[model samples]
Target: DLSKNNKQMDKIQKSLEAFLENKRKEFPRFFFLSNDELLQILAAAQDIRKVEKHCSKIFCNIMKLKLGEDSNSNQIYAIISAEGESVAYQPPVKARSEEKIEATLTEIEQKMVETIAKKLSKFYSEYDFTNIDKSSWVFNDIGQVVSAFSQIIWTELC
Candidate 1:
């Protein structure tokens, strides 16, 4: 019975790690946030009054989010002070423009992959990077990129 409970605990720990990994992969910027900061953002995502509370956590100096209400739809609008950028609640009845072209996560990830590929290319001339999966962890953060190069360089010298 003790062994069974230990196995279950191990399984639960693995599941939680996998969940955190998926979340991290979805937003690499979360890498900069501490466990508490990331968890708080995930938990308080639905609140805006908390906006004023979280300003100092994410921004510099005394910048604040000025909250206003639209009289027509009674929707809330938040203008970021100093920067002047804003976020507003868009009504579902409104039509959105479909013509905007944006680079995909994969495309951006591919660019990141190319950076490390260039480094490895010097030694492994035949290693083709044409089809590297964007999901590769090479460029998720600066530490990962530096660690990758360090491992390769140290191995070569040894």
Candidate 2:
């Protein structure tokens, strides 16, 4: 059986599709962003969004470590909360030792770096940084590339 949330999502999708169809009739080239660029933009956006979403968790975990918690409960909660907003934290009956917590945090940091690397691989494959026209492009070129699709985002609305 389809969950209520799923059903609601389906209805929303159908409505959006209908609205888009009408818009397409009025504007054939409704989507201004290039398809390939759009994908890269979205991929980069997700990474930045993920980082921004979990920054507090990461910061809190580091603070807890500095505070000498001597347990992995807070760190685990940080990871879970960072990864999934819906996740609930339940402190372990047996607390992890300080050494264990440090080791685990080290591992988590490595994994986070790895996840970022994986997400960036697709973008790196597309852009040729070595061949960039550095003279013409300024410091924000990289950011510009990431948000190339949504140029308006980088532009002033007013």
Candidate 3:
């Protein structure tokens, strides 16, 4: 039963795809740009976060054109309008809280330290720095290692 249901859904999806393909051919101008192109355009012109809003507006406009000004279409548009209005009405808050900012910084520092440790661990067994003060030498060694690693794999590191 599950397999049959899945096959039926797949058939329906294929049929929908065909219908959309036909519509796309019929209205080439409206579907000229692919989704990636639209995303790139929005990303270049506006903040990345605003891309979603732009996409939603585009979708709603297309839906309105397809559905025309029927009662059901008006209802759907009204719902979309309300949601857009609500988003616009909301007050902007700080992007990150103090705790979250600190946590992110801590995470970044931990990763940097881990990377340095992993890179330098092989040297530990070969050389003896046991007599040296860890605070001074370890930091300096890490900096050198990181700088060297960054130079060698700068593209990958980024």
Candidate 4:
């Protein structure tokens, strides 16, 4: 089975290499990074904390996005600041297409649902859901539970 897994991994590595090669063709700066570094960046793109260390490598400086809240409206805002390693970091000015942006947002939403579900796994497992009779609601997907939890969170926050 280990050999089989190794074969599969090899195939995956080849596919990933092809994809990254295409990406590098579009933006040649990627050539500066090794396969492992590029893979790390792609894998940790979902979490800023995880990807922060790699910022210096990709951007030539460490950058951080801090979250601040408005006291009056209670709205959250991001403040981008350069860290100690901030030198020669010319951040990209290019904008992705609207379709690509929407797709990335959807991916983020899905990842959030999965993360929340994992964090609440113990409560979800212990709680009985059979009693709640939903006349119109369809409880087919895990994201549905997250949507319901979002409503509860909104109610509590408001």
Candidate 5:
């Protein structure tokens, strides 16, 4: 029974790790938040009295920043409050013209792509790509590098 229990524990641990790895892949910016920060966010999320939809939206937006997603004031507030900061809530401004918003998004996207390319080029130089395979560690590292480069660009753009 003890051996069976140990095997079950190992399976559970492996599954948890795999889930975390998938999350990291999907949102590379997640690594930017320290464990403490994550815990704070989780705690704040639980305390949120808003409706489930709104609460999930807020959490999603905060986490989406890791994926280079743009955030509005509300999302910013959610993030701030999650950190246990006492900040006043100020509503977001009126929406800008669609054309202007589109133009700005296009510019940001272009900049992000260029930045990623440059970073990837530098990263490639440091690796022996000839031996690269899907299972290689370098392949995984490239994904992380791209995510980090994107986060940098997004933060700078914001």
Candidate 6:
């Protein structure tokens, strides 16, 4: 009594269930691409801003899974507690100050850094650091990304 569309839907449903079952068998815990793996993927991206495209096309295929739905970026300073002897913008505070005044990446920011790292590693076999460029959003917002994501990963894991 099924129409062609119904039969097709039934096939899709069965296929998805089978795929999910296979995934469970493959990865005992949830599978996450490692930091290195992520870096490779990002490094290989033709346009870093178009990272979503590269990720969706390449990594999704390799991982056989979906990526996080959102991508966000921000800016933060890398505070230096003690300016080097010859560095500019010297802080008023002396060296070894107990103020704990060094830069700390926010929870969400850290997660983004880790995510980027994991994605970029997929493209670069070695130490690829295209995200370090100031012209790129990833580099400009690296600190914020690191801070944000750190908290996220911690909450999920711990």
Worst 10 residues of 3 by lDDT: 86-95
User: In model 6, how large is the Cα lDDT of residue 80?
Assistant: 17
- The total number of steric clashes, by the backbone 3 Å criterion, in model 5 comes to 0
TM-score of 1: 0.36
Residue 63, candidate 4: alpha-carbon lDDT = 50
Candidates in descending lDDT order: 4, 1, 5, 2, 3, 6
lDDT of 1 by residue, 1-158 (tens): 99999999999988877766666677664454566665665565444344235444443322444444442231233324353433222221121122111112122234435544664454345333444443453444234334665575556557
- Positional deviation of residue 44's Cα in model 2 after best superposition, in angstroms: 35
- On lDDT, the leading prediction is 4
Please report the TM-score between candidate 2 and the true structure. 0.24
lDDT of each: 0.44, 0.38, 0.38, 0.45, 0.40, 0.34
Give the distance in Å from residue 83's predicted Cα in candidate 5 to where it truly belongs.
16
Backbone clashes under 3 angstroms, per model:
0, 0, 0, 0, 0, 43
Model 2 lDDT on a 0 to 1 scale: 0.38
Q: Estimate TM-scores for all models.
A: 0.36, 0.24, 0.23, 0.35, 0.29, 0.20
What TM-score does candidate 6 reach?
A: 0.20
Better of 1 and 3 by TM-score: 1
Candidate 2 colliding pairs: none
- Model 4's alpha-carbon lDDT is 0.45
Q: Which stretches of candidate 2 lie over 4 Å from their true place?
A: 1-99, 126-158
Colliding pairs, model 4: none
